[model samples]
Target: MLISDLDCNTLKTHLSGQGLRFRTGPFSVSLRATIPAIARHIAKLYPHSETLDNDAFIDFHITTHQVAGLRRWLKPQVVFSFDGYKPFKPLPLAQAAAAFEWGLNWCIASSSHQYLIIHSAVVEKDGQAVILPGSPGSGKSTLCAALIHRGWRLFSDEMALLSAADGMIHSVPRPVSLKNQSIEIIKAFTQEPVWGERIEGTTKGDIEHMCAPDSSVRQPPTAIHAKYLVFPHYQSGCLTEITPLSKGRASMNLIENAFNFNILGHQGFEMVSDLVDSLECYDFTYPDLKQALDGIEQITSAKP
Candidate 1:
């Protein structure tokens, strides 16, 4: 069934009477009025994958009609459908659809490549993938946006799916989210950046997101041994500096940022450990984007 065959009208009826369609590399997601801003946030990362198709790598089949009824009749929670499978807990109607789309992408990546998906942002220069893994306030997305504008390729901005056996970072390019000042910073930096509607009142405060270009998404996923695992913190007035971090410390930090490290158990530990061993680890701090980009270029160029 092509994307056209899926009953768009039926899907719309189940949602609260609104619809917006978005595509990412091999995935297609349709959102209703109740959809959250985050879904729109990551859609920019994969531009080439935007074409509607019957054979999507992942398809989110969302219906709001069953959420309340399922919770009341079967269980006391919301229900979401993925290729017809039901998730019992209902997500906030606004974010639920997008969340399901992301979840489906996660399921596909993990199952197919033995990748442990970590909530992170990634940018590539040359053949090396630099992963930025952090919590919401960590300024990763902003930095990623800057780098991509300055010629770095975006691998992903939300989920960094790294292969367990090979240590190559898989590309799952999605939107790059920028909050408050970062939005303005990126807007001023790029001449024609693609952005969705600005969403307000999220836990991270007022927010807006930009989608990566289709060109970035269509490029083949590169298998670069990690050259740097730099943890970034954007502090106002602080000079850009890169400090060395031990492999063991980097491993611990990575585990904390991982989405399924515990699920992978000892193998997870070893995969991450091996990854750190093959790369340089650093704690990067910057008050300016240019300086940070310069530092990153220096690090990447110095690598053999």
Candidate 2:
């Protein structure tokens, strides 16, 4: 059964009691939280996600609760815990849902070492997957949001899971995070965007999460061989440009964005090198979303 199968009262009851176990891509997550906002967030954002049995093997066991003592009554903050250990400090209760999303990202990137995880946004169209690895403020999520709206399937918004053995990209589609001005930009770009509350004054500035497209969430997860490695740069008034990169340079760029290259050591290095060799690496810079979408469409639609 899906999370949508449960009513609000039932969901809250489960959350307050044991937890809500749900399947996200390859991982089984059991999330326990009493925060009403988080309940609403999941109801809207993850309604298509499947709820797992209670006895299932959970990959990430998480809990978010109001911090104890006067803080819970005074400022009202929420702390995120994994396996009973608190990994991060408390944040305002209003940001509980955002905290859960951030906490989940940490869980996957830190523990899921089976895959060569890279800090990138991945989307696919007609069997061609594009990996967008960009630094903060490089318009990665913004461009990803645009592509998914234009009929590309979103693999993930935060990271790409490249399998070590098969060299294929795995899907981990969830809510697309939009920060600061990008929030309004995407709201204006899309016809009807289902967004969480605008969380203000966080470490990442104003933040909001746009619910994943129904197609991206409902579709069964599958591995896709990536065709393009595009590093996006959103420059104001700059003409759309796509410049090819050498394999050597592309490998280095990917390593810099990788989450556990040193942990995997030689295997990770070889994986990055081999993946770059097969991909058409490029530096993509654009001023407007429309032009960016067109530029990507042209390449992804071409003969492989």
Candidate 3:
């Protein structure tokens, strides 16, 4: 059953007690939390994600709870735990929900070595996938959020799980994270968006999350080969431009964005080599979201 099927009381009971196990793409996560905001966050963003039974094996077992001692009552803070080991310092209790999202990202990036993971946003269209690898403040997630809402299928907004065995991009579609001004920009772009509460005054400035479309969440976990490797540069008032990039440069960029490149060793090198060899690599610069979307559509639809 989906998380939305459960009432608030029941959902909170599960979260506070034996933990709430849910499926996010290929991974099974069990989250235990007493934070009230967490319930609201999951209920809204993960409404369509399926819940797992208690007996199921979870890939990441996490917990977010208020810190003990006097801090619980004075300036309350929360800590994130992975299988009983606390990896990060406590954050303000108000940021508990965001903490959960960040913590889960760490879990997948740090442990899921079976696939060559890259810090990129991926979207698919007409069976052809576009792999976007950019640094922070590069408008990566903003462009991703726009593409999925336009016509493309949302593969992922945070991580790209590239399979070593099949050389295909696996989908781990989750809520699209919007930070700072991008939050309001997207709210204006989409007609009606399903959004979590706008969290302000955090380390990443103001932050919010937009739910992935129900179709994206419900789609089967199938891997698709990538067709484009576009590194987007969002420059206000600049004319939209797409420049061809050499496969050698694209391979280097992929390695820089990769999470487990060194961990996978030679296998990761082969995967990067294969991807750059096959993908139409480019450097995409845009002034506005409309121009960005149009340029990408034109390039991806062109004959390779």
Which runs of model 3 end up more than 4 angstroms from their true locations?
A: none
Collision count of model 3: 0
Tens digit per residue, CA lDDT, model 3, 1-304: 9998999999999999999999998999999998999999999999988999978999999999989999988989989999898878999998888899999999998899989999999999888899998789779999999998898889999999998888989999899999998987888898666999888888989899999888788875568989899999999999889999999998998899999999999889998999889989999999888898998898888775
> TM-score, each model?
0.75, 0.97, 0.97
Which candidate would rank higher by TM-score, 1 or 3? 3
How well does model 1 score by local distance difference test?
0.66
Q: Rate the local accuracy (lDDT) of all candidates.
A: 0.66, 0.89, 0.91
Query: Number of clashes in every candidate structure?
Result: 10, 0, 0
Point out where model 1 deviates above 4 Å: 1-47, 50-113
**lDDT of each residue in 127-215, candidate 2, tens digit only:** 78999997998999999987888888989999999999799999998899999999878888987668888889999999988888878
TM-score, predicted candidate 3 vs. hidden true structure: 0.97
Candidate 2 residue spans exceeding 4 A from truth? 302-304
In model 3, what lDDT does residue 244 have?
A: 94
The C-alpha local distance difference test score for the whole of candidate 3 amounts to: 0.91
